[model samples]
Target chain A: MTQRQALSQSTGGTARGPALALDAGLLCILLVATPMTGSLTLLGETLRSALLFLRELSDWMTKKKLLAGSLAHYEFGVEKLAQAWTLAIALAMIIAGLWIAGLALDLIVTGESQTTSGGLALAAVTLALVTLRSGLQMLPFAQPKPRAFRFASLLVMQSMITLAALADDPSIALLADSFGAAFVALLMTAAGARLFSTAAVDLVDHPLNRKSEAYIAELLLEAGVEEEELLDLRTRRSGRDIFVELTINPSRAGSFEEARQRMGQLRRALAEQRDDLDVAIRLRAPGADSG
Target chain B: MPGPTRDQKSKEAAVLYTSLADLAVVTILFFFAVFTSSLTLLSEAIRVALMLLVEFYGLFVLRALHRDRLRRFRFGIGKVEQMCNLAIGAALLFSGFWVAHSVVAALLSVQAASTPLGLAAAAVISAVNLLINLLGWLAMAAAARDGDSAIYRAQLRARAVKLAASAIVQIAITIAALAKDPVVATLFDGIGAAFVAGVMVTIGFKMVAECLPDLLDHPLPGETKKEIEAALLSAGIAGEELLRLRTRCSGSLPQVELTLAPAGCASVTDYCRRVTAVENHLKDHLGGADVSVVVDARKPAET
Candidate 1:
């Protein structure tokens, strides 16, 4: 198979990581920032609560079945409803996260506590929960399932990096502003790279699209337009639209009305086969410079 | 039929609201930047201000699109959105490159200052921006649920990106606030600014690439072309030899043109009937397509 075909086949798998990675990258910045400014008093519990909240959120989402399992099986207008539901779910997660954070903040500001070794376990759980939450959050935003998977993978990467950073020193603030910036920069670069690659594919004609031109040629030939009568035919596909051009010589001469009648027959014949054909037909004599 | 569909009108209103909201936010940000001495704040404010202006112009384009759709213009100005993509893409790219440069310079030589108030202000603005964008996204998403319009999809993406960007800014600013050292805070601020820019540029670049084909009037996809060709070919009449065929698409509508030479001598009636039949056939298949069939007496010279 050609490279394009190969890419097309594996698009499902390839699409799974980037979006997740990008989301993760964003979360990484957030996770890194959390402990930087806040009081360390409730750090473990707050993070642990955050993890618990994510688990509950995930379970709630699973129970509700908010996201469509397969977008294709659904009818056209229905997809949007699913999309809206997903958006609502994402919004709800954000609101919930904020609420939990507020409660955590209240606890931290009101009371004082010492840092404990449990901080490590809480941090790990938080990382896992955040990764799961990020994936769910991105689910509605991504169109195809594979793209969602890709996004989840990216989120995982981001979560891992942030977890590593947090693991280094939970008490003291790390002057790692560059790290956040670098994480974002790296994600952008990766996004840019993907864009360029996708652009390359889009710029060229897909094999299926190319086949359409030939298909048109075959259809005309099958319609009994002799090879000699057919002057020129051109076909091109633009996104979801199609363009076709055909030229042929007539076998008989008659008045304009008679000619139009004959053209009518041809059009009806073509229409019977396909209803959504945008066709323009031109008639010319055998030796004319122009029509 | 008499006026815009409920969905269309709602979408238009949503776009208008977002554009105005963006303008307001950026204006507030600009004033905040003016009062603060942070280079990062000033730069981002300028960047966002440019974005709002571009979005304002985009609102005009959306208006044009609505008017065209209402009038049922033969060639809709749908591709005009491509221009928005181009403009926004430029802004994002410029911001990214500029911010990258700023971050590099900061890394090489740091200018240390304490601006807790500025950081606090940015954090608040980021929160407000986030709220605005989230609501906008919800509105647009709901609007999009009825039918998938390219404009709606674009708006959705834009709102989501804005939300993400705002959240990132808020986090970065808060981190900077927590840092003990002034240089460390500056570094964090620079990083956040750069990250936002990077995401913008990446997305903007993709937008430009996606719109280029539409702006350039690229050919329709293969399946659509095949459908059109099949309809025209099957519509052919006896004694009529197909000569030349050409097809193109404008927005969602397809257009096909073909040359045919009728067999023997044909009268005006015959020509009319033939052309009418073909036109009708095409109309039936490609409902919204602009189809035309021409009969030519003149033929190519024999070699």
Candidate 2:
């Protein structure tokens, strides 16, 4: 495998992290902005109550009698729904986390102590949900669940607090924000349940993406190495990275180091296409038994 | 480039001609209604104008797209819809704010004034507007399906939104005219305009966001990255860097640039042979990729 291809695999296990982080950031902003909206506080709760709704939706879609069982990412009768639910749940979790954190910083932690219990709980739930989803995404690679679904609990509790707030309740803006997060999350979950009722895995042809193919062509065209010396070529793509195998003739040389030098040049050229690629170069005799 | 299919070309011409005809109808009606200061006639004329504007927008967009087919989102032209969404969304949002403002004010100062001729005008306007909008909807769908342009897509969406807006306004006008409440009728128009604005703004925001990643240069699909690396490895070469790769496109073809170490060939002829092999390998994997290779030995190597 080429070094760029190897790097892709190594990094592939972590690509979802950024996506999770982005979602978390978006949620946090929404949750924090809740208290500022005053009468629009219910809008914020849209997020807090979202997690349970998503979980319920996921369960309904998967029909997984129990949420505690070990289910592979691929297996399911309603896999598409499950996948959609998972994505929604994960997205909600991230959003909730951001909301709670923002709420905590903006109102919960600094605000009155007694009124914040609900907000704190919902934030915790959101965190937990986010952690669970992130963990699942990378489980095949091995790592701790990124965070706890603290936002969910926080969202639910905050929502109740918001209800209280709405009816001449205390100044639990923090709680209101958490509740907003939950509410939005729940609504999204419900909507997603209807829209997505199965796991989703995208299988696509990759090498056709143009960048990889062109890069390879450039290397060979520029290398100035004889096409006759080049015996065979094979390429396969999985995800964004392409793995290449080729065989070429070894010309008369004073030393094997010269051939090695030529190989190094080729490697350097390939790297130009993508530094994060895995490349495997195999030297073989002409017309030898090759797979 | 594949020439436009016969049906597609014919449909394109029909859509354009029909839109123009619709515009002419709107103009004639508008003049006829305004000559007598008929509010009902005026409302119908406005609907016709909007429909004409939408069609023209679709036509121009289609023309531009056909002229420049290379413009696309990654490998496809998905970004056109995305951009249109942003612009329309913004327009809708702005329109919504304006309509809301007018409605709030009108509600505060409920005024009733309608030309005595308004009763006769209302019926004519309602009939004309309804007919025009329905025709516009059909024309929009045809243009949208036939032309792969953001304008056509936006026109389609705009028509759908207009349908709802027009329906609401129609209901409001019908009730107000029955009650002889001129203020309510005016209020309905303002609200309809506002609704259009708000919808456009929402669509605009969505488009802007969808297209942001491409502008930011996110990596290509992972499978593509691996394919290129594997091709290099299979060759009798090793230690090559799949250096900074940029995937761009011209029309439908992908353009790839791979910077690599200079060929370490004993002779220039031998060097050309090796490069040709890699090029062939790339072409085999990715059809019609324009590859550019730069030879620079000293670079940060990835292990």
Candidate 3:
């Protein structure tokens, strides 16, 4: 196997197994609670949880396939697939948000107030436990803190909504429940839209950020490759891997061997910067077509 | 980098106009679905909305290509196209599930009544949807005929599916309106929604299957591999001089990378010319491909 394949395997092994398990448990609780309470807020939360569960399940399955070497044939790696998956998740989130908002609006307009039930209480307890667990887990890992915080906030909001539904005053309860559903819907939509835009840019094959591009230029200069000799430089990212393709006119070099050595030095410099980079250098004959 | 050809620009315009038209029709259909409370119309609306999202995405890709925005991508934008198709397929799959669920729910509640006015409205909107979809389909077919673009072909296929689905929706809604028995009307509505779901699943599976191999960078077909070898031989590359050859397709563009042992050439310039010849021969043989040929100076025997 190639170095990339080995790297892919290592990346695959880091799949969030515990997080997936937690999501599955949350989904089960929401599934049971959604039908019993008939609260729009709970239903919206249920749908969101379901989508999150599916996303994690798909992520796990893709990583399993990666570890099994099923995707080893992909020369460019499976970063695009990961980006596509992110896009899918974003689309699903947006759809769920719209669906929830529509249902909440219907409830408000039709004056349909659902009664509180034991299921809602149980769901609230479950959310509290999950939120606490997620927050505690984030204490040890700084990288996942943002995601954990988001999850915790969503759960806290759901718990508060559930508590509102359990209020004795029917009129106030209905208002809080309906408004809470709307709030969750808006939150989901805004978050999904943000993720969608980011994933869309990646799917469009945008080049690396300006900082990375500048760094690459600095590296080339350090390797004794002049700006004028560089005919082309292209950089893109797929998943966790960075791909750099360069075309150089080596006419000024004393010999072809010396130019080849310079290319080798540039490759080493890039590799030292990032192990996940895949670099390809092409020597262009003077006056040759860059295409 | 070269800008998109006139042919490509024209194709992009066709896609953009049709997609905008589709969005309008689907939006009208969705409101009508709400007004009429027609299960069939709702299913159609949901399916078309998902499809239109994908159509607009394809159009965005085409415009980007025409504007030379993706010129820096070394392997071209084939992977991007495939990824877009894959997303469309997933959306279709989700639509199928939602429609199936709606069908089951409607069947379970057979007493659901439809007002005469609502039924009439549904029938009329379904007809309008069918007519617009038919026009869109024909336009896509004509556009696809002008070029061998994978995006256009995929768009054409999607249009055909939409046309068929609209026809199904029209027939089902018409029958439901005409039937006197409430049970029969509900049954027709359920069947219509079920059939549309089936169509979504079938096309979604095809799109996903077609994209996976290319997206996964599977090797070129045997025939194409043989053609590459023949082109290399025709370029006067000795069998032993060919150190490594790898071939894969990115979207519709074939990508070939070759590592050659520089044994026969006398100087670096001679070797460069030979490599260029090999690259040109392969590109010509493959019609148009991203071909990169390099000298493997590390080969012990060749060195």
Q: Point to the candidate with the largest lDDT.
A: 3
RMSD per candidate (Å) reads 17.8, 15.7, 4.2
Local accuracy of candidate 1 as per-residue lDDT tens digits, B164-283: 877787788888887787877887787787887788778878876776544444555678767766876787644346665555444445556656664543464455456667777877
The C-alpha stretches of model 3 lying farther than 4 A from their native spots are A1-70, A111-115, A141-145, A209-211, A252-258, B1-50, B67-74, B87-97, B112-117, B143-148, B181-184, B216-219, B233-244, B295-303
Residue-level lDDT tens digits of model 2 in A101-182: 4444445445543334354444434444544554454556534432333334444544554354544445555455544544
lDDT of 2 at B43: 52
**Which ranking of candidates, highest DockQ first?**
3, 1, 2
lDDT of 2 by residue, B116-148 (tens): 356345546655655666777776565455434
Q: For residues A223-243, what per-residue lDDT tens digits would candidate 3 score against the true structure?
A: 777899888787877667777
> What are the clash counts of all predictions, listed in order?
112, 151, 1
Per-prediction TM-score to the true structure, in the order listed:
0.47, 0.39, 0.84
What candidate 2 gets wrong by more than 4 Å, as runs, is: A1-291, B1-4, B25-58, B64-127, B140-151, B180-194, B211-240, B247-256, B261-303
Q: Write the per-residue lDDT of candidate 1 for residues A182-248, one digit (tens) a residue.
A: 3333433343344333332222222224466566666666666667866655443322334344545
lDDT of 2 at B167: 68
Give, for candidate 3 chain B, the lowest lDDT window spanning 10 residues: B294-303
